[model samples]
Target: MTVYQLPVEVTAFARWLTELAGRLRPDAGWYGVFAARDPEGLRACFDGAEILPWDVVESLLQDAGEPADGPLADRARALYAAAATAHDRRPGGAGALAERRDLMERERRYAESRARELGERLRAATGEAEAAGLENDLAWVRDDHARAAARVTELTTRLARVEGHARAEPVPAAQAEPAAAPARTQTPVRTPAPPAPARPARARPRGARYAWLEESAEERAPVAVPVLPTGGAAPRGARFGGGGDSAEAGGPARVAEAADPAEAARAAANAVYALQRLRAQGRSGEAHVLLCEALNGPPDRLPALAAELHRAGLGADWSTLLWEAASLPPGRLAAVAGVLADAGRAADCDQLLRQGVARPVEELAGACAALHAEAHHREAHALLTAFVRVRAPEDAARLAGADPRGLVPQLLDAARAVSATRERDLLHALRVAGLAGA
Candidate 1:
């Protein structure tokens, strides 16, 4: 059963809940309409589809197909909290929590793999705007991956702790260790090759001792990993990292790095993923040493690495790389400056802009506007000194006329001081502009 959008005039919120309960009725018989493996073709089926990880809000919203926004969407809006808390008080066993933990681990690994793919794209990106956007997306993917990793760790560690407590006797470390997987090192991307769904180790009702561990992924709060739209958009000729597995596997996982981006991007992505995985595993010393090695390549490699770092949200490392690349030719400086200005790094941005900028006059204005939008001291001043140099007399007149953010005044002041220097010509243009405006 499905209710695409709740009726607009529906008064009580309980009506919406009634429909949701119907749609998500727990597995009762042989057929599971609401199951992760919906047999009736009523839901979107992908690999590793479980009955429902109600804790994963994205899966619910997607399967529920509820209109999330607009006037018609108002009634279903209450489900966000309800659905996130669905499993909070549900009963389960040790094996169930362990299964959920394994699911989370699979999801975390999938997210990291996706981050690598995004980093690969960042490598091939050339335009600063394109690179900046790719980097931004990569950063989002990275953050999401971190959240998934945390959830996995949380589930893994908590279940172990509680299970150990419930044990009748002390189990040997070698025989009864927690379900924590070893620290994930950089390895080839593995596509999940889940076979027929049979009861794997975690599927049994081993004990009800860890039922308390059945708390909703959201209830245990550090923020549950929102399932991203890593939907069925598999890469050509092969499935990418996200799909194709989220269940107990019957055979060896398939290696799947062939669909990744080309050489430059692939290498850049590999380094980034390795560093992040190492750091997440608490191998900071290894990550640091690896990072140093990655950064030690020729100067030409700095920009790509820096861009990738930025995309990965490694701000400190990104900043360092950017500074290191500062000595390179200024071909891409203007574009980089545009991004920096948008990021509120006006001083650094302007320095790059002033060193030399090759972008069109119009783009410069846009960059200045971006900077001004970010900060203004009586007026928006980005690489205005550079701006005045390339600006046409008409533009000079225009800028001098309004002096939005007092830009002309600042330029005029600077020109007054630099008149005896090489840029003294700027003083004459400002004068011409000021006279023309008058």
Candidate 2:
């Protein structure tokens, strides 16, 4: 028995065949082995797998009985047709189409304008020879214009057909196959995979406090955020320590130890700003990891750092970072939660509330209001109800006091659902105050 290694594409094709046929076939295994040795040869045998040349694949699928008219068959036929068309147009088809359309339009306009100029010249000719010459030139211009217009029309029709096929529903397999297959004489050009582009160095202004915040002239750099090690420790050499010092002792550490809090805050702010730039450049995952470093650093500077992030339009990214960290200090948790809620990420805000319920009531009130204002009534109801159930009656009362729009009825419903008598009683007091419906 001849052993054969299958390429990834051939394996995928076999899987697609199995799905379409609703049963595995021995031939699929053979095809997989056959494809591994000669993908180009297999493609040739199938007469170009680009369009509807599915004669070979379809024969294997039909072995298990013609596939029932279902989503599987419909999708397979449609995907096959699309794959063929895409393969045929792989050489900058979209860009080429646009450029051709523009060129034809310009040519048509120029020809029309030239014909008009020649017509005017023909009228001004003083002799029959000049008049005849001008008329000939005008005729040539008119013919060119006509040809350009016709070519434009042909291209427009072709483009419409291609676009229509793309948008059309998948055809049945029986209807999908061509009545007569076209000859496949041309060999496909195997374009080499392009190398990854390097990130360009960005120029920064002198004395700029947060140079990373300035938009770079080059394409955004791809930054992979390093995952925190187990036990939630900051990565080695991460500069998140207080007094602008990294925990790892070094020259910068020696200098940071002597720096004032103001200088430390500025350094920390710049680091956070760099994370923001990463987020802006579509590297949110990496930025999130770097942001977690801040959480492990100085807890005291979190509010100021979060505020800076908020000002830079990265409130959503910061919310995600804070939520992922899940170990923020109570003060920083409340501050970040408020920012998240204000930014309309009520889900993250709710999680924060659940984690930091021990924080001062005053600090939690803004987030609660933001949730309520955004009509995240369910989350707000649950958070408040949980607080009422877990905290003392006075703390729950203070929470109720913050509810100017009267969420007592919603809280009562939540309390009743959970069978919490204390929460029910607390809501009843607010209901008695006419803040809730009877």
| Clashes per model (N, Cα, C within 3 A) | 4, 2
TM-score of model 2 relative to the true fold? Answer: 0.25
- Give the Å error, residue 13, model 1: 70
Itemize residue pairs with steric clashes in candidate 1: 36-50, 36-51, 135-311, 379-405
What lDDT tens digits, residue by residue, belong to model 2 across residues 198-269? 766767533223322323435332221112111122211112111111224221100101224475457557
- Least accurate 10 contiguous residues by lDDT in model 2: 249-258
RMSD of 1: 26.1
The prediction achieving the highest TM-score against the true structure is 2
Can you write out model 1's per-residue Cα lDDT over 1-438, one digit (the tens) per residue? 954442222212234333554665356422233354444333322211122332333334444565433212322332222222222212353566678777766777777788889889999988999999998888867766765655554354335434533332334545443444578444333343576564333432222112112233232322111111111111111111122222232211111112222443555666777778876774443554454443222222334555677799985555433432222222122334444444455655544444322222333343344344424322234356544544334454454444334445565554444345423555466566544223
Off by over 4 Å in 2: 1-350, 428-438
Candidate 2 CA-lDDT value: 0.47
Each candidate structure's TM-score, on Cα atoms with residue i matched to residue i, is 0.23, 0.25
